[model samples]
Target: MVPIFVIAGIAIGMAAFVLLIQMAVRNGIRMSGLIDWRTQYELERIDDADGGKPTLHELYEIAAKTDSAPDAIERNVRAKALDYIESRNSIHVRNCWIVIGVAVGVCFLAMIITLASSPM
Candidate 1:
């Protein structure tokens, strides 16, 4: 039983570590402003061309209604940005929860192992 708990704890810890790394990389990309460049460029382009400010999603909707080649390209870029933001945010939330859960599991396992081996 003790060995099993030890193994489980190790596995959970490794998983938490991987999640931490992924979160770090995701945040790094976001914080470094790499993800915003394309979105910003697109918004600026739309602002210059139309002079009517629209949110990214709004721009995507507008582009969808248009038949112009430029609008098609804009729609694709906006879609990609929206998708990236959504996915990255979900990953961040999931990583936080998993890491917290793993920490709690490790603590519980430690307590159980200690109680099992200690003199009662």
Candidate 2:
């Protein structure tokens, strides 16, 4: 149905807006440089202190071997994991926003043409 298509279009537009906002957040993090520095510094320290560089999965094994509190290890690991997750999310958000923007633009044009022809 036409109405259904219009609704879908609007939904796509809203999706785009949310995605764009997410993209902005990701860019902000990159610009702030905290994620990069923290991730790198922590990884380097982890490598140096733990005998060698550990892949992310290996961090768990290293933590298990240490006498230190598991909580601290888990916390640091979670932080690193989140950085990776966010990096991926940023890309998805950017793509969604672009698709949504195109949908909304097309919908708007359709609405304008429909409205102009109506004899109200």
Candidate 3:
């Protein structure tokens, strides 16, 4: 029979791993500034005095400040911001899932190895 302590250890390890993943996602998004830009604001348009590529923060600032919510420029900025955040989040989720899949596969393989090697 499988040991109760082994089962408990696996359960605790999985729970801890899930909690770590959750905390990583929360901290990663916040650290990347995606969390800050998630808002409905009435700021002001950011002038590109240098006429160069504005940062995402600047675009967000200009995007939310417009009086007309759906104007071409504002809509474009909004779309860009949404796409940026979504893409970043997608990447993080993909990575986490891949790691989980790999870990599960390794554990499964280890179990098979042990079961096959054991005497009948």
Candidate 4:
């Protein structure tokens, strides 16, 4: 019975981990065409969303509105968006990992209690 509980706990933990990954993948939709997964980290610092850095797209739009050259603004927006996507995605992934870890712990605890209660 203990082994059964342990196995069940393990299965639940693995499922939670997979669920976390799925959530991360789903969140990638926010980047849509703005980011390609391969080169996202190069465009912006993932550690610094609050770095007061204006998004490239926002800069581009603002500059274009102010009669500045459009080309650089467009390029920067695309690059910045890519960076944002990468950084945000990484954050999501980290959060999910933590969630999975917690879920595993909880499942294990539940399993232990369950097995302890079970008897011939």
Candidate 5:
């Protein structure tokens, strides 16, 4: 009976987390594609309704370069700039995912330990 309650609580918590993510997504959409994935804030590029134009590349895609570089990122071709942004953004996104994975793993481990140790 205790295990049943514990499982039900976990389910409810997970459902709440899903709901929170959905709310974040809705809010971001309402606010210029700005999303905070509980780890960091990232801008999501949304193209125009007709698929003719995307949001300005400068809005979301900032070129990553060293401070010592003499070359102006602005001089680079649009494609190259976009590529650099994608790579940089991917690094942030990958870290976010890893953090999420670690969190979930820790939670799972805690749950197992709690259940195993419980006399009920």
Candidate 6:
């Protein structure tokens, strides 16, 4: 029926929107961590002479070599950075779950509507 098709179309569109929002949130969380890590570690200076930035693995190696056993200031900064990153990640994950829940609910509603409107 037309109503069932309309409901399904709307549900599909909303599900796609929810997925896009989840992806954006996930990417934003990752990018925020990357930016914070780069700033905290002065990763710009770790680049090759040809101006190529180091890969994440290389950056980890550099950090391992340089950042052993935190001093007082370093310890405080590390703790704060970790707290910020964790909070951001948690918030993003929560939002993603909400979107996923909505998508699933929409699909369920569409299915119910479709079945109810169909002839036996």
Give me the candidate number with maximum TM-score.
6
Candidate 3, residues 2-118, lDDT tens digits: the string is 444446546655775786588476647544654445341111112213334456667757866764565776677867756655655565566677667665765675566557656
TM-score: the better of candidates 5 and 6:
6
- What digit string (tens of lDDT, one per residue) describes model 6 on residues 11-46? 686766868676776557565655665353333333
Sort by lDDT, top down from the best = 4, 1, 2, 6, 3, 5
lDDT of 1 at 119: 77
lDDT of 3 at 58: 79
- The TM-score values for the models, in the order shown, are 0.48, 0.39, 0.47, 0.51, 0.38, 0.53
Per-residue lDDT over 7-118 for candidate 1, one digit per residue giving the tens place of the 0 to 100 score: 7777777777777777778556654667574664443445344554556666566666664687576767566666645555566667677787777778687767867876
Which residue pairs clash within candidate 4? 56-77, 57-77
Ranking of all candidate structures by their TM-score, best first: 6, 4, 1, 3, 2, 5
Per residue, candidate 4 scores C-alpha lDDT tens digits across 47-118 of: 455767664545566757755666776665666566666667677778777887788787869776776778
lDDT of 2 by residue, 13-98 (tens): 67767767776765566545576544643444443434444466676666667637888878777666556545544665666567
- Which 10 consecutive positions of candidate 6 have the poorest summed lDDT? 40-49
Q: Which stretches of candidate 5 lie over 4 Å from their true place?
A: 1-75
lDDT of 5 at 45: 37
- Model 6 segments more than 4 A misplaced: 4-70
TM-score of 1: 0.48
Candidate 2, which segments miss by more than 4 Å at Cα?
Answer: 37-104, 113-119
Better of 2 and 6 by TM-score: 6
lDDT, candidate 5, 1-120, per-residue tens: 656756765765576567556645544453432433211222323311233333444422344332233254444434443553455456545544655565476557657766886887
Collision count for each candidate, in order: 0, 0, 0, 2, 0, 0
The candidate that achieves the highest lDDT relative to the unseen native structure: 4
In model 4, where do residues sit more than 4 Å from their true spots? 1-21, 24-59, 65-67
